[model samples]
Target: MDVRSSHPLGQHSGSEETGNEEPEQSVQRQSIIPSRMEDVICRLKDEVGYKKSFDVVVREMTLGDTRTAFFMMNGLAKDIALTEVLKRLSYLHGENMTSDALHSFMNLYVPAVQVEPEEDWNKMMTNVLAGSTAMFIEGENRALIIDAKSFPARGPEEPSLERVVRGSRDGFVETLMVNVSLVRRRLRDPRARYEVVRVGERTQTDVCIAYIDDIADMELVESIRDKIKAVHIDGLPLADKQLEEATVRLGWSPFPLVRYSERPDVVASHLLEGNVAVFVDTTPSVMILPTTFFDLVQHVEENRQTPFIGTYLRWVRFLGILVSMFLLPLWFLYVLQPQLLPPNLSFIGPSKEGKIPLVLQFLLAEFGVDLMRMAAVHTPSPLATAMSLVSAILVGDIAVKSGLFINEVILYMAVSAIGMFATPSYELGLANRIVRLVLIVSVAIFKVPGFIVGITAILLLLCFQRSFNRPYLWPFIPFDAKALLNIIFRMPVLESKTRPNLLRPQQRDKMPTGNGRS
Candidate 1:
């Protein structure tokens, strides 16, 4: 049924401003809601451009003897719900709404649970644009803002990056509420808080900081909160990554300051350990803060298996990560100084130098691998297999056979690439590739001293790095024997009953006697 009524165009006789309102201030910053319906409609049309945008819908109708207008953004609010609200309003009579019409309409007409009265015109407009339906009564000083936000979203499918062989299939979605619910389902503690802060000026994107009020360091939470509030950007178009750059101020560092995981279980586990999780709207990945190098090395699959199996898997991942970062550079070092290799181990270097210089061959191979990887990412899913086959069989085979690269170079590059893929954190993997290239260039230039200086420089950089004031290297750099041991070996969950000392959580004990809640 059509609920719209034609509003006769009339010249707006603006009402007197409140004594406290400053006339010198910009009209957009003014908070007062106009008492005149004509003025309200005119301002909405002029300021919000209701007449210009097709999605900006304004339903005008007579409720009893009072004229009401509902401003809504199209496709944001539920149709059936608004229809029911309108139907309820149709039952109101001139007699019942004769006195206090605004009060009667709010307490009796609207059926939604999340309704509130908003007095500020700027806030009302922001709310209307953000998927709320605002009711502007003929003579009321405030608008009734109805919360009926229904953003387009997908189901919580398993994230492609954090999939496991044995675990819950559900993962965080792009919707903020859904992602919060996913974490709340796993953690039912009343002390768990999801504090939201709006960051962007134009976009006004929501960023939630989730942590246990009692367990999490309030100072850390507050510091993060202040940083988010202090953001002066016009929009958060890139979501978490943009926020990370704004807040962390990561200058030239290639390493990630925060660990990202789409798996709710991973986030929940981090919260349990007194770490904070930041959930950004429109992104499935949740950023875990105060992350160390070891945290990036960990995978949920390790915890899914038995203690011994988990330890084994952790060791293998460690080995792969090490190889991905240093294997190519170290192998090049041996080739540069063949005497460094024992007589029995001298078979490592290539038998014959290729047409290209040895250093140029490595650089070319790295660039080609990165190019193919990017091409595969952009390629259609159906054609990805063909692309891979062409890269491996046509490009790789032709290059090696033509002596553009020796057989050993191709083999080592492939091995390093495989190790890079095995890395759990994609950001860390890319950072490792950069480090490998740095080491390779150093070895090519200054030989032995270059390799030593390169390794020492990288180590010192990491040693001095900090994530939210917590040491980035953590257990290793600070020399926490027990924590380092835990990193080296995956211990049983039940046996490990204390939170990380680095976070300095308010609550140190994880397994308290009564139901395990703070």
Candidate 2:
């Protein structure tokens, strides 16, 4: 798992250019950062595959007759930043450049905000690869790393999934710096901290952890940090979702332990409530960690409305999520035992027979819905209306008339699908779909016993599940009355004083008592 294999771009050869310095083999054996300018460039050219890659720019310049090189990736460095640094470095002459002039240049002339000394070749490689600018000088064992990283990303637009009738339209973009700034713009708290981690040995993709110092639990933060540090993957192709699966230890659990959001307001809200936000580069969805089951069910739109309206919206969403998860299975269970159906609800079961078993109808319908969903994603905007019409007319109507699906079966499945779409978190929706399938399969085979057992198994799984050592089924499993009530109702911001005790936040109160509104 040590991804320190032969460098992918490296061109290993004799160090003929390293005049009067260690041989290439000797340099490779020691893996040392040498002080000689020729030896440094020689080693780097071989390691970075400078000949093979054109964008890996190594601009050799002189500061007062001392040979120096500025290393950066072409598209990553901002033109203004690079030009400013170049203008400043161009002015240096005479006695300013001497032994340890690298330190003096860094101390006085370096205009970059984040500058650090790096001596390890491994660290230097990682930094320069991650859009940072590295400065190396002759006769110096250390290099200055300028944190001038700007990733290619789209400007923040309204998030399609987490949109609100009223609030900020700007959402988290693929760029990590912009995402961090969005959260910082909201809180403006000095205690807010963004700790960056370099994940993926080859990709060296930047992952940032955002949390408020005193407000967030340090133990929780440390646990999350340690788990991310423990991730030894070559690359996270799926980005935050992959990182979530690795760090959260969610093995085959259908429930989502961590919630995701693209909106900065949502992330900022959770940070103030002692939750940690994990931002992975090239991904807009930021992972909010140590989240409970109840947390995923709540939506930001609830807070955007008045308390009464918010409570109403929250309940509607809660009902939709519950129905999406359990409605079809319970209805099928009723079909399995029609005798148990109340006289008023006797019409629920399918009245007509099909080529398939009753449970098979639900399964096929589930797959059919998924197929349509996938088709919609790939379908162009202009063709989307036509696609929907085709699906509705050909697929839905033909399936019903052809008796592959009964009227009751199609009706209930459609209802359940609606509920799934209404659910706030897409991850939770997918998980609920799996749960629904399990329940349907159980109800089909063993009738009442299988249905009971499957439900119990789900409950057990949730009961045992933990997100970073915090109970997943919190407030309900541990029975916290106040917390449960808060989840059910969106209380006015002014009335709510205490942060959740479950998070164990350093500041018990949201604001000092004197800050309360009249």
Candidate 3:
């Protein structure tokens, strides 16, 4: 179905009487065209109600004494800079002044003036909202767009999640210009490229893609550009929403294809590796495309810390991920199939029998754990500690004493919850929770064999998943030995010379070692 015709009103057909009244309608339509144009502007203004949050200003300008009207949003505009431009515009003395002449005057004569020639009125209006001043001519179809953007911005600050001890602490900010500067500051190479794209129908938010010109693959850049262009939304509420929708090959998959980080070092690393980093306006998080499962697990801090310590931490994280997904399910399977377990392991079950069914007992324990976690996350910091104590000590202890849940099940659930928190990305942690339930159901139905099969299926699905033609399980399934070593065990910063092979970056080497350095 055509998107335009999908609306309920558009789907409804006109009556035969309405069709018969076409002759009269044509006469009325001919008379109403100009009025309809006025009505269009009126309705647009009505729809965008004059809220105090938005400062709407209607200013009248005279070029060569010819009166023209301009509308702009205050506070969003650089009033001081705009005043300078207006001072120059108001002093026009020539009667033969055309739009082009006025544009030239503004460009050449006015300080810090940017002129966009022969622009569409609607697009120009969007620019106006984005802090550009628009100039309209009486007879011309085009308008002049001037850069007067003056929204307040702060410099990049230290990243909270991706803190690095040795590397740069600076991270991307909400402002696009500031973010671009941050990247440029780190990478002074002339080959570094930044392309800004406007997204969102109503928001018209600025999204920037940064990469090294020689290092980044041309096709990869084009693919990212196309995906970003195709997004048609009112506003990009979060960078993740756009990145998730654009990067995912299989939208239904729980695995994340694109890696998100707040650290500029990580983004710079990805850019150096040939992956495109998308920086959305009003969001600090930068998204790296064509990422693998390992990318999300790796951190910039790994490169900063001692190689041995980093490797140990990586292994610990991997183990945590495993426990988070299987601990509870393993307990469930143990309860269901006590005979399959080794002779010594069978004695682990509670001594006292619980009145609730084993599955129900596990479910109730899981529910209470999840509830406590949710409450802790949403609650204030002071209340969070109190709630945690109440839930962990009072609720959990009472449930165990009442014989509603087994102590072993509760213990496993708590351990699994802690393991889930070890994951750096919140989205991946949520996916882990979902996969845990699937593992539990599989074990309940088909015992240990079912659990293994379900895990195999998940791995197969992950192996099949792609992000912009790059494998989702990079450095693992495709088996790049060097990349795998780097991913599995942290490589010394100086020893690592090449970017991840999965991205297929144009440039292979990031740095060259001097002789005798080792």
Q: Which ten residues in a row have the lowest lDDT in candidate 3?
A: 28-37
- What stretches of model 1 exceed 4 Å from their correct place? 1-29, 515-518
Candidate 3 similarity to native, TM-score: 0.82
Q: What residue pairs are clashing in model 2?
A: none
In candidate 1, what residue range of length 10 has the lowest lDDT sum?
Answer: 1-10
In terms of lDDT, model 2 sits at: 0.85
Task: Please report, in order, the local distance difference test score of every candidate based on alpha carbons.
Answer: 0.88, 0.85, 0.72
Each candidate's TM vs. the true structure?
0.94, 0.90, 0.82
Relative to the unseen true structure, what is the C-alpha lDDT of residue 459 in candidate 3, on a scale of 0 to 100? 92
Q: Model 1 over residues 1-518: C-alpha lDDT tens digits?
A: 11111111222213314443233233423556777889888988888887898888899999898899988998987777898899988887898775777788788778988899887777787777778899999887778999888888999999998889999999988889999999999999899999988888898888999999999999999989988899999999889999999998889999999899999999999998999999999899999988999899999999999999999999999999899889999999999999999999978898999999989999999999999999999999999999999999999999989988899889889999988998999999999999999999999999999999999999999998999999999899889999999988889978898899999999888788787554
1-518, model 2: which lDDT tens digit per residue? 11122223355453435563345545543444667888877887898977578888888998777788988888887668878888988888867765668778788888888999876678888888878988997887778999887668799999999989998899988888899999998989888999999888678888999999978899989999999999999988779988887888778787888898999999999998888999998899999987888988888999999999999999999999889888998988887789989899887777678878887788989998999999999999999999999997898899888877788888888889999998888888899899999999998899899889998999999999988888888999988999899999899998888888778888888866564411
Clashing pairs in 1: none
> Which candidate do you rate higher for lDDT, 1 or 2?
1
Judged by TM-score, which candidate is best? 1
Candidate 2: segments with Cα more than 4 A from true spot: 1-31, 95-99, 514-518
